[model samples]
Target chain A: MNASVTARRLPIISLQDVRFSYEGGIEALKGVSLSVARGENVAVVGGNGSGKTTLAKHLNGLLKPSSGRVLVGGEDSSKTSVAMLARTVGYVFQNPDYQLFCTSVEEEVRFGPKNMGFGRDDESALAERALKLMDISHLREQSPVSLSLGDRRKIAIASVLATSPIVLILDEPTTGLDSVESAQLMATLDVLRSEGMTVVLITHDMRLVAQHMDRVVVMSEGSVALDAGVEEAFSDPDRLRRCKLLAPPITVLAQRLQAQGVLPKGAATPLQLVELVARVRGERQ
Target chain B: MMRAFELTKTKVRYPGSDFPALDDVSVGADEGEIVLLLGSNNAGKSTFCRLLNGLVPNSIPAQVGGKAEVLGRDVRRTSVARLATLVGMVFQEPDNQLFCMSVEEEVAFGPENLAIPRAEIIARVEWALEAVGLSGYNARSPSNLSGGEKQRLVIAAALSMRPRLLVLDEPAYALDPAGRLDLYALLRLLRERYGMTIIIAERDAEEMAELCDRVILLRNGRVVADGPPSEVLSDIDEVVAAGVSPPQIAHLSSLLADRFPGKTRPFLTTDDAEKEIADLVRTAGSGAP
Candidate 1:
């Protein structure tokens, strides 16, 4: 788990006593605190109304906290323009339709870089890199409306990545994606992490947390319920239940076998079927 | 009862596209049967679903050819208002169909739109909510509910319409594991208890194989395969080529079927696969690899 060492060197983003309420007087975030260091891939997991999206919006200055502070690259987010925030932290909305405003994929990918005042040649270079990163380089001239929903989602992500933000926040990135799209997107996130991009992925998929994240932070009712390594977070099924999440089938089966005396107690969460087979074989050995 | 007799032989062409979204396709569904439509995205799965409720030719831009009937009525001729009473549709995105302030209102919208008696509307709303296991959610706002709750609410709204068939187009695609489980239970209850002919356009091959009585495999708007899910899903290469994720246990069994050929079964659920494996282990004894 890429837990911060000194909160320096990588004090890229931090939330202090953050609270948010909509115009209708509904409190979405309540005194939430979080810190994300540079190069850390931290997954924020929770139920639907658990303030994960609220927390994510704060990271990129989309939704400023009411009574507290949000620090982006050690600068107070409230004082910064969204234009400036977009350069330091890129936010990808869950529904691609909400974000994709351009006509063609190439133009969509170049929108952010162009807005950030890059010249035509530089914008083309950034757009090419982003589209290649998303593996949609061939779709440069295709109309955004003509692409599949999965492809549109990737274009939205590519548009965000074109800005070249150090801290990237994705809200429910895998929603509505088929298994193949989910795998491809997760691989892209893995590559992004390897490139020293700090990623805060907000999602409800525990399998995603188990497979991709460096750390998993559970949120319940607008508060941080559990913050720990992925193993530690997924180990406690009850805590996961409280947060309204479920372990993958393999992990549940392993736990059941352990309970039924077919396997040793304290069996780890098995992410894949091979891991479960290995666990059972080790126990028999 | 609700039955489709050699139905779905329709040719649908989208706007400005020469190719049919669904080519000549035919299938049938019986009352109390859960029929799973398995295919990848843009495989005319959604087009087939729209054909069920007559939304294809009515609201959407499409030219549907041939006879596509639902509940003994020609879908092309049947008005959407009349079709809604026979086949209720729950779309993939719950937000698109929902606009009511409270859960009760959302469910009641269908019955009230049909001009059902207020007393009967309340009763139907209650029964629908109970069927979806959201009995006490009448006072709750759909906007504030979880993704699963909103999905179930959509199902309840369809149920309140007293439809003979329920067509769900990827209703659980956006949900988490627990939410998906809840939706599965709700679908099962609709078929078993209420005798609703449930048609699901799904990508989860294993779930369809286990829960559905029959499977309809569509490819480029054609009925490539139509049979019991066991036969359709057992062909792993076909399912993979169609871009469908095979059931986890079926995948595992296929992996071991090379070494232990007889142990292979068209298993969908994890426990069923485990039981089959355990029984095989006992029979094979030390010969198992």
Candidate 2:
């Protein structure tokens, strides 16, 4: 492999003029074109029926486009087998119950690696490491079916992580999780990104998107309404309103303060917002 | 009237679990009040909601102790069907509860099972749908509705029973922010118009703080904190330690407490925080120093 040639290769996942419709003629994706580079933390956000999930499915070859093309790892996704693509992209469903069927938590996490044809020793190591990363190593012996939703979600992510995919797609991973669990899960994803894994998250939590993700893809009526960096995505109010989304509460506060010239123009997380407010107070005194 | 529901030192352990799902939990809500249950997953919030309608003891095989009462009926003694008449329950997943062909049928299923009069059932079906802002969706298939619509349909079905109290276990789990706002608005409507007591088990304390009259914080199957939203949410350390993040406004107020002195108070919504900050800036600009 030529090092510079490989470095300049196309995006890891690319979709051009992709359109998809369900069996009953319900158009889910109209004409969405997007490109995601390696090791990118991207968040897909929109209203309930704006086709965020549909677009995610195409990236993993779960669904093929009606028109145009989807390329995964520089290969045509539609021509590739989903099983073959599974090694490169691991998709975690929103509900763990939809995918989890193993007897034990350890077995559940090990299933992905085993299915991907890892050796027995490697499988065990991956499973153990994934479980430990998710903070669920203690539940390795427990039945996944008997665990709480939050714990099951962690198990599902661990199972996907055990597969060691370069690209990870999570569909609303924090839907039922509390703030602490959400923060912990995001931290795990951050670590994975640091280790050169690409993460694509589908979520409705603006706070998570603003604080965690580097890029944002806003979907509206099956098309890409806005695709920009985290700051740009939240700062653009018109596009967000067009897609029936709002900036995180902290961002909204910052915007209000900015309007009054109390704070400089910028998007801030809750913690950052506090620091900004304190700085303004100090300046006033 | 007596409190809507009260749990007195209630404890529940599942059939195979070693630890209790709910450990000596005691809480109460008044009539026509909205209570938000804030906790991390497996903190007994669902178990507490189950106890409201006898699902803990009657349906699930659980070791139970102490007392639970809803609408003057002991949950331990009352049949699940009987408790359903007074305590309406909506679960997290709407698909789990919806089975009828059409929205009208789905709404009427609850009342029909209760052996309500046919005329009253029809009236209730109409009333419930209207209350949920789905008045014209009676003939629509539940499968065809959006996630938010399905959730509202479930809420309508629960309301058709005309229960005095409604308990929802993470009802907004599947909804987007817009959908969640609609649901919260509908919940406030339900409380104001129908005088229904509402208990919501939620993870988003920020959104809940603006709507809930009181907040109940649970951790490790125990009640760690219980008070009005302002007081309960303002204790940032306690709330965060319990694995529940306080609302952004509450966090901001706490951060600004030293700077703003006595003016800083727990705020539930962005508008509240904005007003306080704007006031502070105005005072400073007018030569307060």
Q: Fraction of true contacts kept, per model?
A: 0.21, 0.66
| DockQ of the candidate models in sequence | 0.29, 0.52
Which parts of model 1 have CA positions greater than 4 angstroms off? A2-9, A119-121, A254-272, A275-285, B1-8, B100-105, B113-119, B133-146, B173-176, B205-210, B228-231, B258-267, B272-289
TM-score against native, each model: 0.87, 0.90
Query: Which 10-residue window of candidate 1 chain B scores lowest in summed lDDT?
Result: B277-286
* Weakest lDDT window of 10 consecutive positions for candidate 1 chain A: A265-274
Taking the tens digit of each residue's C-alpha lDDT, what string does model 1 give over A44-99? 98877778888888898988889899999878989998899888999889888999
Model 1 DockQ (Cα-based): 0.29
Q: Candidate 1 — which pairs collide?
A: B8-B25
Relative to the true structure, candidate 1 reaches a TM of 0.87
Report the CA-based lDDT of candidate 2 relative to the real structure. 0.87
Q: Candidate 1, residues B1-289: lDDT per residue as tens digits?
A: 5475337567989899978998988778777888899888778889889988989888897988888888888888889999989888999989898999999999999889878888999999999999988999999999988788899899999989898889999887767666776788878878888788888898766455668888888877788787887778777767776777666556665655654456555465668666654544344434454
In candidate 2, what are the lDDT values of residues B26-72, reduced to their tens digit? Answer: 88888999999889877889999998988988998798888888887
